[model samples]
Target chain A: SQELEQSPQSLIVQEGKNLTINCTSSKTLYGLYWYKQKYGEGLIFLMMLQKGGEEKSHEKITAKLDEKKQQSSLHITASQPSHAGIYLCGADRSASKIIFGSGTRLSIRP
Target chain B: GAGVSQSPSNKVTEKGKDVELRCDPISGHTALYWYRQRLGQGLEFLIYFQGNSAPDKSGLPSDRFSAERTGESVSTLTIQRTQQEDSAVYLCASSPVGTDTQYFGPGTRLTVL
Candidate 1:
């Protein structure tokens, strides 16, 4: 019954390595957002893309929405240990509702 | 100096007890939403409040769950006769009208015994 699907449910990378996480939706997304959460903490907004073929970046993290509007990717450049956490992708069909992906657990070792 | 705020960061209650969780959205935010996240699961939409006309309660799992937002500012989610399965981290988020970015509050962790 889950609509948003994310790959590599869990990932581990060495410091300075790059990593990517992908999210695909069964239904078209009107708005796609990326968030990061530390264990037991609230989610921090990373980026939001509303238009297809749109891309945005924050710090070392960059996110892109494909032209199909049903898929998105989040890439981290030169990953750091601090970047380790749970990454979540949420699709909002409208401002009223959002469906979340089963987060990607990222761990970085130095 | 202000963001969405939730109360009683942790709550542990016995089965069949009722519980109320509170959220105070940022000033001037017109859109508010509630979500629940179970262990090892993604967040699930619970309810939404937009300017107090009427809330979208489509996500409520059962009649035992209900929520109310007062005057477009604060919201309270009430669970009547909570069951053991009603344990999760309940998150509250607020956004201004027509915006996609939502600011989330540290959720309330509810544990039913």
Candidate 2:
């Protein structure tokens, strides 16, 4: 079975600072996804990366897949309170199943 | 367009009881999936359904957990003889036939006492 590991299990940063969260997979990744959840709410899709060396950004957040396709990183520039949430990385284990990382809890101090 | 929707946002049941959670996928989505998220943990895949083909039940934790999808519209996950370990948020996701990006529902929080 494939597994995903996220670094910095929990992080606290100033509202204006920048931070990066990393996700590494034990197996070669074919498809990787990033999602954000506010406390107990549902997950909100952020972005997806399929090809190696691919990078995508939305607003102030950016995600990049490594050339080896086994690691991905999400960077937040000038984080805000709205960016405080649980960030999870999911890897496609098969066509229909996705295995998720334990998740990184992010908090922003105003 | 509406995203995936789930019913009974929260559920409370006793041990040894049976519970059913419902999910309504987006219109025209041919793939549906069920997952469980425990407290402070990531999502765990439970089952997957694609169109009329047999569902992939390899992720189901045990025989007590089962799910069914009617056509490509609605899916129901049932837990029989639930235990305390069964307490978690049950989530459902759906996507188009050719895509792997899934949209998730609000999820049903189940508590077993």
Candidate 3:
């Protein structure tokens, strides 16, 4: 079975600061997805990376898949209170089901 | 267009009881999935249905957990003899036939007492 590990289980940062969260997989990644969830709410899709060395950005957030495809990072530039949520990384295993990381809890101080 | 929708956003039941969670996938979607998310944990895959093929039940935690999808539209996940460990948020996702990106529902939070 494949597993995903996220770093910095929880983070607290100033509203204007920048932060990065990482997701590492035990095996080569096929399809990697980033999602955000407000406390106790449903997940909101952020982005998806398939090809190695692929990088995509949306608004103030950027995601990059490593050349090896086993690691991915999500960077938030000038984070705001709205960026405070649980960030999860999911990998498509066997092209059937998605396995998710434990998620990184982010908090922004105003 | 409406994303995936789930019914009874929250559910509470006693031990040894049975509970059903429903999910309505997006129109024309060909794949549906069920997952469980425990408190402060990651989402765990439970079952998956694609088109008319047999469902992939390899992720189900136990025999007490089962799910069914009518065509490619609605799906229901039933947990029989629910235990305290079964208390979690049940989530449903759906995707198109050729895509792997799944849109999630609001999820049904189940609590077993």
Tell me each candidate's RMSD, in Å, in order. Answer: 15.1, 15.3, 15.3
Alpha-carbon runs more than 4 Å astray in model 1: A1-110
lDDT of 2 by residue, A36-108 (tens): 8663234667888888999999999999999999999999999999999889898766533456787888999
lDDT by residue (A16-86, candidate 1, tens digit) is 99999999998888778788866423466688888899999888999999998999999999999899988
True contacts kept of each: 0.00, 0.00, 0.00
lDDT of 1 by residue, B2-103 (tens): 988898888999999999999999999888888886654456678878786688788889999999998878999999999988998888988777554467
Candidate 1: residue pairs that collide: none
Task: Single out the weakest 10-residue window by summed lDDT for candidate 2 chain A.
Answer: A36-45
lDDT of 3 by residue, B1-113 (tens): 99899988889999999999999999998988888866544567788888899998888999999999988889999999999999988889887876555677778889999
In lDDT terms, how accurate is model 2?
A: 0.85
Off by over 4 Å in 3: A1-110
CAPRI quality of model 3: incorrect
lDDT score of residue B53 within candidate 1: 69
Candidate 3 per-residue lDDT, tens place, A1-110, comes to: 32899998899999999999999997998888888866323466788888999999999999999999999999999999999988989876642244678788899999
